[model samples]
Target: MQTISAPRADARTPVETPAPLLHSIVLDWYRENARDLPWRTPEASPWAVMVSEFMLQQTPVKRVLPAYAAWLERWPTPARLAADAPGEAVRMWGRLGYPRRALRLHAAATAIVERHGGRVPDDHAELLALPGVGEYTAAAVASFAFKQRHAVLDTNVRRVFARAVTGVEYPANATTAAERRVATGLLPAADEVAAEWAVAVMELGALVCTARSPECGGCPLRAQCAWQRAGCPPHQGPARRGQSYEGTDRQVRGKLLAVLRAQHGPVPRGQLDVVWPDDIQRDRALDGLVADGLVEPLADGYFQLPQ
Candidate 1:
């Protein structure tokens, strides 16, 4: 995949404030049509919101729903998760893929327990300092969970901004410094309003301004959308690369983890060897898992999830 060359921050054009009607329209649509996701519920805890953000990274919402519920039901708070063995987190993660996220969540839970008194912090910097919480996750938890005024720029929100504000079919392949300025400029002045605006824009993109086939007719911003006004041009930049699963190390890792997860304790090295035929790839996958802290080896020829 070609790297997208975004203009330097100084050279980028300023983003105009979206019309007030734009907010009302999108917000109203969100209020009515937004998916009844558990994370968005009034009763959802800050921890729940943060967990959802972690699970939703590259995974879809549908796959996340059951896992998210089971996770919280088992470990209702950061303290609970922190107290449990890390292997349990991995087991409960259950085919979510990128099982390392489960490990990171466990680490983050431990950090929250030690640093924040088991509370998911509202402060962006504190959230960022937690394991696996990056700029987007921190902003998401701060904005969606705590209702703080931060620019929450995920893939969905970026798509919304690209089409509605920038008249582009897609955002730059990478989140550039200039994109940060665009999000900042368009943020509402009032903190509460800005928070609502953030999620509203994200919801719009998820439901309406979708990546491959946007349902433009149902979009609240269709009438005023820049992309619509300009006749919705196709993406002209570098070709987007599709993630291939076949014959990949990721697939091998998942197969290895599945074997581990099916058992209650350590498995013999020979047991793991039978999952994949390629000796080198299988060995590389096992080594990668051990390096990632997802697997631990005993003095004997037995492998287990981290204790």
Candidate 2:
């Protein structure tokens, strides 16, 4: 294996990434070891890829699989989903957590139908213009769905770059301009190959370079990893911690939504009040849900998901 140089201070001129070797090793590993995800299939339409990206945000693959299947089964096309009430989208979202993504996806589908004739647009700029389509989601859709050249910097890809090239155990708490430059620099020159490279790196991070308990011995990048070369040093930056779900407002919100989801039509305020113990906390959670458009208030103090 060829020894790649270390990354320099100026990320704009990053020359440490041996693009050819990295692509070769990672892509080969991906071909053999990549998860058989529905979205990665050649038959997966751009709409399917768009849906996966939305659901996968902060949600795990195992949890997303069944929901994804059911979602596509019911609404395979953007037009199909767009035609349904936004409340149905939220209901279909189930216990996926972060129900706001459901509403955003519905809005995006509506925009797709209106703007692009019900087809998910291949143009990166056009994708970015859609509702709930941010930089990461737009790039992911363009590359994965359309095989276009773009740096798809999700958390997984960022962690891979941090350890493999930048000699760090983790990336910054938030994405930096420097990180974007590093990602762009590592991209292959060819559009289709670059798309493959992006997913390969992402897969590498997801499988072998995980945030905790990485299986470094099995990692394709193990030999070339800068963090490994540096003796697998500990994270020197701010302390990393996982978010607590129990007893939090998010739990209360989920519980409140569950009741609304189970019922057919509008639910009375008193029914919602029984889910949580504290009156103040339950009221706050319900109010937050209403403000977020996840719940619609009806006449006579009844509530339901958005119509």
Candidate 3:
């Protein structure tokens, strides 16, 4: 067991070798312990990886698996998705929650077609330029799709690193340059294949090193974890806010969209009214759906999936 000191917040010391060593430990553990997710399969296309990334955001894996398979089957390429109607994309998104991601993914596909000749961009900068592709997403595509050496830091990866490397109970609210520098230090020197390692680590965090009730006993990085070494310190900050689904606008919006998605064209306001009781909240939710471009209003005051 080896220990490394946490760098000062303002310190810019070159990232040390412990990160790569820890990465190797986790990657090797991933090789043996990794789940056989569809996106992780060798045959997964770059487009498939991109779609999976978007679907997995804020959504659970079990919920995403079927949708991911169905989405790829429907649109095997960015060009295929770009050619489809935006409404169709929303319809396919179903009840995955945060339907905005589906629209953003659709927009990203359109951008791919217009800007990158219908190919998912391999370059990090170009991928970042896409509608929904952010730092984590760009790095994910670069590594998973192109096998680039970039560090793909997401919530899972951030927590894993924070615990294993820095002995922190919680990761910062957002990733910083210091985090990126630390992540870059952990990346394998082999520039072409390090992305797999990044995804592997993230998977480990999601499935094993979870925020609540981490299965540290089964975690591969347990032996190297700083937090584990420190007796798994309790999270001391204010408890995270709980999201209310019952009677909330999001629930109302989901119900409204469900009706439109299930039907062919504009559903009557009468039918929409059946989904929720409160007119004010229902109207607000409906207006939000329309604003999000997930629904469109018909001439007759009915609502339809956005065209």
**How many clashing pairs per prediction, in order?**
0, 0, 0
Model 2 scores worst on lDDT over the 10 consecutive residues at: 1-10
Candidate that would win on lDDT: 2
Candidates 2 and 3: which is better by lDDT?
Answer: 2
* Candidate 3 residue-wise lDDT, 154-199, digit = tens: 9998998888778887787779887887688777778764777788
Candidate 1 structure quality by residue, lDDT tens digits, 91-181: 9999898888999999999999999998999999999999999999999999988888998999998998788777889998889887787
Ranking by TM-score: 2, 1, 3
**Alpha-carbon shift of residue 304 in model 2 (angstroms):** 0.9
Candidate achieving higher TM-score, 2 or 3: 2
User: Which lDDT tens digits does candidate 2 get at residues 33-145?
Assistant: 99999999999999999999999999999999999999999999999999999999999999998999999999999999999999999999999999889999999999999
Q: What C-alpha lDDT values do all the predictions have?
A: 0.88, 0.91, 0.85
| Runs of candidate 2 exceeding 4 Å displacement | 1-4, 7-17
Pairs of colliding residues, candidate 1: none
Instruction: Give the lDDT ranking, best first.
Output: 2, 1, 3
Candidate 3 lDDT (Cα, 0 to 1): 0.85
Could you list the CA RMSD of all candidates, in the order they appear? Answer: 5.1, 3.3, 3.7
Off by over 4 Å in 1: 1-18
